[model samples]
Target chain A: MRHLIDISDLTRDETNELIETASDIIVNPDNYTNKCSRKKIATLFYEPSTRTRLSFESAMLDLGGSVIGFSSAQYSSVSKGESVADTVRTVSCFADIIAIRHPKEGAALVAAMNSPVPVINAGDGGHNHPTQTLTDLLTIVREKGRLTDLTIGCCGDLKFGRTVHSLITAMARYSGVRFVLISPDELVIPEYLRNGVLKRENIPYVETRSLDESIAELDILYMTRVQKERFFNEADYVRLKDSYILTPDKLAHAKSDMRILHPLPRVNEISTAIDYDPRAAYFRQVRYGKFIRMALILKLLEEAEE
Target chain B: MIIGSIVNGIVIDHIPAGRGMELYKLMKLNELKCEIALIENAKSEKLGKKDILKIGEMLPFDYSILGYVDSRITINFIENGKRVRKEHPSMPEILSDIIKCKNPRCITTTEQELPHKFRLSDRESLSYRCVYCESKAQSN
Candidate 1:
């Protein structure tokens, strides 16, 4: 009955277990090769995503499981007016498990309510992506070897970043976690998240506009693209774009031990020149994404039969 | 102070002053055929000025709604002109098809057929969030 709808669905221990499982997979790939050999994973991606859908497919394949289902709503019966409930009910008969990515929020919940098989929310309209949180956690733990007592500086698009919201929720549970929020005033973190979640939990956090200064103290710097489309004024986008971009000069100011992360598909927000730097964890973050998903798929399927 | 007691009806007492009319409208008290007197600004020992709803007949009412409107309300069931039962409405953990989710990006906004559901998150603050998006419900 358990589904990966939100990052908070898994506790600190459960999240740690996923990180541990992914690490174990990295060491002994052969041990988990046939764990899901006979299982079928149906990916009901209502929205088109290159990384998420392929990551799930890649994970299922790596686990020795078969992958089925559509890439977008236009290709499926959804174009002919099929409800998520109806689609999932029908898919339940065909597949042993489901990983759904939809543009609508709570679309996975609708499918899970109707689905007989185990359901994993790949991504649901910037609402929750537990699997990505798993990937981030695994990367952080692998790079830093610890989860708690670290300063996490989040730069750019804090207001609309689903990853930022989920990470804040997950990291708040751990002790000695401080947040350094760096963003333009227009794109500052939502008050409800700051007040309802962080303030309620009593987690220490500071808001600032300077990424250059904040970089020196952070153990982990999470960068997100602040889209030009989000700005009503073209001038505002041009002014703020350069400030958030991580260049070589900015890297020099940062701690040599600090790790840089991004949920990829960057557009000038991060300088390509910094990719060669040992501290840039974004590209390496992608490969670890597959391993975390493999661990998630294995865990969900294992827990489903129980 | 002597509002006539009902023989076989329910008395909704302890509603805050001036809120009874809103409750009456929300609960659709006008739809009932029985005599319903909305006593506003009634003097009370505990409350200086409270409202009392005196119904003349027994009918099935959704008392669960009272918890949302005003939890301070006490419903008294009068059987044969004698008080039989007195209890407050029970607050629900989850409410469906009641309050609409206001978040523009929420699934319910695009999927019109989906039920507008909210879950009671904090009891002390009476905070309810959209089950789908976790956006706090804006109280009317």
Candidate 2:
């Protein structure tokens, strides 16, 4: 693919190839250190995102390439009313590849359309973050040893959790994958998702307001923050957030090998006490996130050569 | 029938009753200088009541948006005051710059020159999502 706008942009074989590349990078670090030694990557972040921005920067720097561009929109030409298309076009003159995180949906699509180099969408509103999905997949593959025939439970804000949405989209292409959607009724998975991806793909799924009831059956529990702002009533947020929290006590009923995953910067969704558990794969997932991005940067640069 | 048939134009028939004015406004029929007739509450054996529109000019009609608005609409070609062929408009695979993407975060909303595009995601549900963001289009 020319650009990484959504998880669907990459075929299953391409996704697996990236995972393999990342695994190879993990083992033979020195051999791939200076792969992009002469190239430059522009982190054109039109939004303030510490983790994603750092991840992209690290991906380029670790590959022996230079990183450029602003960390936020306030510091960029966008403050002077520059359009996303124009900003990407301008960056194309300097950078060999561009990674953008924007507050607006489809900002990367605009960048991709205008960019002379390959464009990678770091994150665009709540629309998509394909790299995050890549990280999650790698994490799951490492922990579970396979992607298919697994019961994946997504907890908390399934309504607005782009990570969960992307995970579902990617995993649905596999065989014997089932979804256990855990969220409050108001924050339930969108109908378009249930009707569009799950039903259309014939992927089995079951929904519940309570995660505790289904925790034992899940092989992977993907937790996301249930923000207070998403709830119409403060009382509802207070009441519902507690139901989704993953404490050690909650994991008592869970599978012995159940891997807990989160797109971190988590806010009380997964307890700090649970971090001590061997099954908690979120931190390890961060390293995979960096590697997958490294693989993506190299892949895009290689594709640009043709 | 209060108006005569078109000499050479389009005949939009079988629009559900009470939708003629909406279709008229959406099509901007009033903006056209050529003759156009809108019949409300027209009788039909297939439909208890329906609306019909006749335009004496051939213009590009976004069939996808029309399919979304009213799939039952039948468009008939009239040549020299005779019906030549009739077509039942079905949803197109891709729709461009007809139904606007209302999501403020959408690229088309800010980059005014770019065409607002949507691809049919769920043909069974008659669902169309924005090509860029994949957000479901608000066809209603």
Candidate 3:
């Protein structure tokens, strides 16, 4: 009866409950293996995304559910101009739940409205990705042992990074959570998010151009790619591209316990040399991603039964 | 050369000739309790044709609703068979909540149970955007 079209739809308590359920699944994977035995999950990905699509597919598979639907829009009736409403309504008759990713903003919201089954937004154009935020939250809670009172530094492409926006919104709900935003002037945290979410919640935060200065002080350093396309000026992109690189030498000042996180598909933002460092948790975050997704699939299917 | 007049009501005049039906749909005046007269294709040297809506009873209207359909509608507050007050159109700060967003991928386009929400991003330009999908639309 409910859809997760936006992170704001989930209250702080609901978020914590999901995290707790995900944790329980991690502990007892056997008990939830057949949770969605005869159910089906349709992944309607309109864009090319191997990692996220595979994550959802694998999550449903692990929950003993079958996966149906296309990996791209080109293969679907969308190429012939079938409307999203008609597509979702038809798909709902076959699938119990749907996960959709579209290049257009609010596409999932649209699908959710027409879908008879619950809808999950995998990713929509620079808007929101609540699932990725869920994965990140689960990773942080598991790695940092707590969500509050931590100095979380988010670096690169903050303006357009949906992941960054979702993470900031989720973290702002916790107490004593300070943020250090690291990005070029063009990619600084958007004013809407800064004023609407951060300032409104009275969450203490600081913005800086130097990632090195704040790199050591952060309890968790989350990195995202600063793509050249996001820049209007090529020269500016070239100048600021290397400002957020997380090299092993840079980790020297970081606490031995300081956890480094990245959403993956790193384009030199994170140096491969830091892969050996025990503080690097991005790879482990991937494994945790699968586990948490497995947990999510079980929970959603169980809720469908109720 | 005489036309029927309401005993005690409002008269919307100077509605760009043939656009009275559109104005009617925009205001949803047919759903109201008052007696309505829609005079269409009336002779006018300036517009070549014009239409008028004479209501038989006083009905409250925001008048700003005219901004969406036609800006030429002139509302006359007739008192004792005298035009006491005449109101003309001005640019509106907000647009009507009707007219669904054209973007097929927009949430508002598919959501049947929710009210279609739009915000006038540029009033002078007559540009509006879907609050959910962020799709831009312009009034032509």
The candidate that wins on DockQ is 2
DockQ-based CAPRI category assigned to the predicted complex of candidate 3? acceptable
| Chain A TM-scores in order | 0.95, 0.96, 0.95
iRMS per model, in Å, is 1.2, 1.3, 3.8
User: Which stretches of model 3 miss by more than 4 angstroms?
Assistant: A228-243, B1-116, B119-129, B134-140
Error of 2 at A214 (Å): 2.2
lDDT of 1 by residue, A122-204 (tens): 88886788887788888898899888999999999888778888888988988999999999888899987898889999999
Residues B1-140 of candidate 3: C-alpha lDDT, one tens digit per residue: 56666667789887887778878877788898877888998877767888988877676777876765566668887777777788887646555566666766555543455466667665655666776765676432
lDDT of candidate 2 over A1-306, digit per residue (tens): 398988999999999999889888888889788999989999998767777889999999999999999988889878988888889889989999999998778889888988889999998888899999999998888889999999999998899788999999999988989999999887889887898799988899999988889999999999998766445578977876766788888999998899999998888888899998988999999888998999999999999998
- Each candidate's root-mean-square deviation in Å? 2.9, 2.3, 7.4
TM-score for all models, in order of appearance: 0.90, 0.92, 0.76
lDDT of 3 at A186: 73
Candidate 1, DockQ score (0 to 1): 0.62
lDDT of 2: 0.87
DockQ of all predictions against the true structure, Cα-based: 0.62, 0.69, 0.27
TM-score-wise, the better of 1 and 2 is: 2
Lowest lDDT sum, 10 consecutive residues, model 2 chain A, at A225-234
Candidate 1's C-alpha runs over 4 A off are A227-243, B1-5, B25-31, B37-52
Clashing pairs in 1: none
